[model samples]
Target: MRKILHVDMDAFYASVEQRDDPSLRGRPVVVAWRGARSVVCAASYEARVFGVRSAMPAVRAERLCPDAVFVPPDFTRYKAVSRQVRAIFLRHTDLVEPLSLDEAYLDVTEPKIPSPSATATAQAIRAQIREETALTASAGVAPNKFIAKIASDWNKPDGMFVVRPSQVEAFLTPLPVAKIPGVGKVMEKKLAELGVATVGDLRAFSAEELQLRFGTFGRRLHLRARGIDERPVQPDQPVQSISAEDTFERDLQLYEFEGDIRRLAEKTWLATRRTQRVGRTVVLKLKTAQFRILTRSFTPEVPPASLEELTSIALSLRDRIDLPPSTRYRLVGVGVSGFRERGEADGQGSLFDDGERSPDSTGRPESL
Candidate 1:
């Protein structure tokens, strides 16, 4: 059996803020800028107890924990720390797949360092991280990626869990179906309607029945329900897309979305600078007041080279929306895709070359 480990830093951003500032050590800390549009990047455990969490609006976090200390995100420092943790992972195995700045999957089936078991290797890595970075991390060891990922979160900050190959089924059987990867609230509710509330319950449905109901995802659910995930851990996976979206406090008409579109575009533009790739497609996403989602995209011959060009293109996409002028929207998103290595794409297409616009049939955001 292959040995996989999912290592995740505990409240990474907030922990760093606390580690560097002694005065903030014991207090509720939130990492985010002060603004109506700002979202919480991370929340310390102290803040989490008060219902504060990452991705919630800063205003909501402030209201949830009135005494919380707010600190602006310092990505430069976070990236530096991430690099340090990555270097430590390399000491055990080269098969590291980073999911984000704070979490990664490592295949240690044939580790560089000698260990009696995957659990031992995980403990060693966690110990080394603590000694070197003065930061805590949680880890999960299992036969595959999905289960390892779930086990990693079973124990909170600075903990570890292991599931041997023989124990996979028993470990997964009683858990809620929502614990499966990709099983979000919508999927959970759908499964609930079918009398499938747990992994054990999901096992009762034949793969063919599920495939008839969920398409390709039905097959995946079949395997996951049986504690099977055949996917391997791949190192250094390339970035396919980057985007930012927001749900407004109130619904807005089509013309009223221009400002939000521009702001989201700028946010997406700044995020793209973190990578060395160039984006060839600009995408505009909208969610109607009734929760219907629509997307419009454009692929210019030449990739946008400046923030102004990106913003202008995103704003221009509003023209393609065929919805009624009175149609109100509750959310707006801006994105860039078709990433190419720097200098690999020679912008040869004409400017303002628009692509197809389509509404999501799944009533969900398309996976980037």
Candidate 2:
């Protein structure tokens, strides 16, 4: 059995805020955007007591915890701290897959640490994080990734939980079916109506019965019910797509959103330029005032010929939408997908594909 551990920082953004500001420590701290339409990014445990949570609307968060100290998200500092945490993980094992800036999954089946035990490795990593970064992380160590991810949440801030190979089944049973990933509130209600509210209940049904009802996903549900995830920990996974989006401070009509779309497309284009690959598809995304999301994509015979062409294509996609002309939108996004490495393309030009003058790709004499 492979030994896996999931490390999750306790309210990462809020904790970083509290750590940087001594006065904020031990107080109800909420890290979120300070705008009417903004949503909470993270909430400290003290703030959570008032029902404040990440992704809750900022207005709602304020109503829940009137006395809460709000701090806007600073991704730059968070990334610096995240690097430090990742460095700590590397000491125990090189097989680390970062889920986000604040959480990661480590496969320490062959630990680099002197201690030969996964539990001991987890403790060491957690202690190092607390001591080095002044932030606590909860860790779950188990025989597989799925179990380890769930086990990590069993404890709160600055805690650890372990599920040994012998205890996997017993630990999984009796837990609500909702605990399984991908089983949202709607799916939970459906399962409840069928008299299956727990993982144990799911286990009582055959895989064939589930597949017949839920199609391909039903087989997945059956496997998840048995705690039978066989996925391996992957490091340095390739970026499949790149996109940037913004939620407006105030809703605007469809015709009033061209500027934001172009700006967002420019941002997305700049981001894509950093990659060695180019995407063949341009996707235009819009979120309506009622929170309905719609997307339109145009995949030309080749990648966008130029940045001007890209921006124009995205704006033109807006005209293809069948929504009411007076319909308002709260969010807009621009993205590119269907990536292909530049090295694999035949006569495909570099970053600026407009047949324009290219940057220096000449011979380099000095070190990189």
RMSD list, candidates in order = 5.7, 8.4
Predicted candidate 1 versus true structure: per-residue lDDT over 1-368, tens digit per residue: 89999999999999999999999998999999987656688999999999997767688899999999999999889888989999999999999988888889999999999999899999999999999999999999999999999999989889999999899999999999989977877788899999999999999999999999999999999999998898998887777888998878778998887888889999999999999998988888887766567778888888988889999988888889897899998788999988999879466664353432222223222111
Give the Cα-based TM-score of candidate 2 against the true structure: 0.86
- lDDT by candidate, in order shown: 0.87, 0.84
lDDT of 2 by residue, 5-93 (tens): 99999998899999999999999999987778887888999999999977667888999999999898898889889999999999998
Q: In model 2, where do residues sit more than 4 Å from their true spots?
A: 290-305, 312-327, 343-368
Q: Which one is best on TM-score?
A: 2
Native RMSD of candidate 2 (Å): 8.4
TM values, all candidates? 0.80, 0.86
